[model samples]
Target: MIDLLLEMFSYMFLVRAVVVGLLVSLCAALLGVSLVLKRYSMMGDGLSHVGFGTLAIATAMNAAPLTVSIPIVVAAAFLLLRISENSKIKGDAAIALISTSSLAIGVVVISLTTGMNTDVCNYLFGSILAMSKSDVNLSIALAAVVLALFLLFYNKIFAVTFDENFAKATGVKTGLYNMIIAFLTAITIVLGMRMMGSLLISSLTIFPALTSMRVCKKFKTVTVCSAFVSVICFFIGVVISYVYATPTGASVVIVNIVAFLLFWATNLTIGRIKK
Candidate 1:
């Protein structure tokens, strides 16, 4: 396995994919902790669907995918929050409505413009070859911003995640922080979608948080564990996919699933021993 990964690293595309994946994993995991705690986890799914629609439109228009998708997804994220706050459509209903509609639009656009070729398949299932040098550079810059922002606002985020009303009462600007979270999440989703695909990218934002929850009790501990787990799982999955010629996104998700199960079992065993 070591030899195989060393051989795989020699390829430029593989290196780009690895770099992008690791950075994305870290950003997603960091944001995932807050999203999960706040019950906004499905936001990532909805935003990824929005990214799919924007990416499809970008492809049809022959524009840069990230440039087109980023702003649109960011707008949709804010819109989703506004709708949730002010309209009858709330919570998961708003997410589902937007998610399904965006997905449908993307499919229709792709069908009409590209006729569902290998590139379309790659968008749905993911392709390591999709990570160009420019994509890696953009991802690195955006991922750094996410990490820095998260660290800068960690205390405020913690307050909002656990108790929005209380945080607002304490004059923490809950709405503004929520928007910041939404915007950051939008960026992470779009960045990840290139490698994890529209359909599976949310897994990167969800699985790490869930897996860490199985073993950790404190919020900070869970957040730390989630970041580590996400990065390790992505690394293992990428290597395994390269060695076995499997789908990269699915392989990463599979590794996450296995990690979650192991964590759950360990927690259960510890509980039983305590009894």
Candidate 2:
């Protein structure tokens, strides 16, 4: 076991993969709590598609995919927030529309430009094995920014999540907070795309939060537990992928699902025993 671990840790790529995975997991766990509470669980899905579309466009234009994706994702996030304020189009509908459109655009653009390659598969399914030092640094920077934002607006975020009207009545600028949440979501989705893929990125935002909520009642407890769970799953998944020569993103997502199931089952059993 010790030899195997040392072997896994010896490679620079593996080390980078681990760092990126941890950063993505931490940021996703933090943002996911509010997403679930606000019933915006699908927001990750939307932003991921937005990221994918931007990536495709960037590829076609010979630009860096990350650079292209970030601005577009942020803009889409802001637009979503604005649309939500209208109250005419429900949040779910808006998300669905935007998400589907963005994904379709991505698919069409890729078809017209690159004609598909292994890179497309990697992007769609995740490519932790392909992680570089630069990717790790980018993930770290994004996570740091997300953490700083959360710390700065913790109270206002708490209020918005629990009681938006109360926050608005108290002049908390709920609209701005809503936009900030969306922007953060976009950033998380973009960074997460490489680790989790456009297809499974939502799991990073959903499963951890769901599993933590099952076992913890307090909001802070949920965040702490979820982040812990996310990191565990990420590391375990990377190890499994390395050992089995499997797709890292899929492996990580599977680990997260297993954890979610275990938590959910345990909750059910305890509830039955209580009864």
Candidate 3:
């Protein structure tokens, strides 16, 4: 297995995939803690769907996909939040409505323009071959920015996540912080889309936080553990995918599911022992 992994790393595509995957996993996990605790986890799914539409249009126009997708998705994130907050559409319903509509639009665009080729399949399901050197560099810069902002606003986010009403009462500007979360999540989703696919990218933002919650109760502990677990699972998944020729996104999601189950069982056992 070690020799096989070493050989796999020798391939430039695999190396680039690993690099992007690790950076994305860390960003997703960090933001995941806030989203889950705030009960806004599905926001990632919604933004990813919007990203899919933007990416499809970018592809059709022959533009740099990330350059076009990032801003549009971020704006969509803000719009989703605003609609959820003020519009009569409400939260979950609004997310479902926007998500399904964006997905449909993406499908229509792809059908009309590209006629469902390998590139479309890659965007929908992900492909290791999709990661170019330029993509990796941009991912690194974006991931760094996300991490820095998260750390800078760590305390404020913690307060908002736990009790938004109280945070607002104390004048924390919960809305701005919420926007920050949305923006960071939007960036993470766009960066991850090329590797994890529009369909599965949200898992990276969800599974790590939920799995870590099974064992850790405190916010800080859970955040740290989630980042570690996310990176590890992504590495394992990429290796397995490369060795066995499995779909990269599906492989990573499967690894996350297995980890979540293991964590749940271990937590249950520990509780029984304590009792």
Compare the candidates by lDDT and give the number of the best one. Answer: 3
User: Which residue runs does candidate 3 get wrong by more than 4 Å?
Assistant: none
Number of clashing residue pairs, candidate 3: 0
Name the TM-score of candidate 3. Answer: 0.98
Q: Which stretches of candidate 1 lie above 4 Å from their native place? A: none
- Candidate 2, residues 154-265, lDDT tens digits: the string is 7777899999998899888998898888888889889889767888888898889999998788988998899899989988998899999998888988999999999999
Winner on TM-score (2 vs 3): 3
Clashes of 1: 0
Q: Per-residue lDDT for 219-270 in model 1, tens only? A: 9999999999999999999988988899999999999999999999999999
With candidate 2 superimposed using the best TM-score fit, by how many Å does residue 167's alpha carbon deviate from the native? 1.1
Please give the TM-score that candidate 1 achieves against the real structure.
Answer: 0.98
Candidate 2 Cα RMSD after full superposition onto the native fold (Å): 1.5
| Residue 201 lDDT, candidate 1, scale 0-100 | 95
**How many residue pairs clash in all the candidates, one count each?**
0, 0, 0
TM-score of 2: 0.95
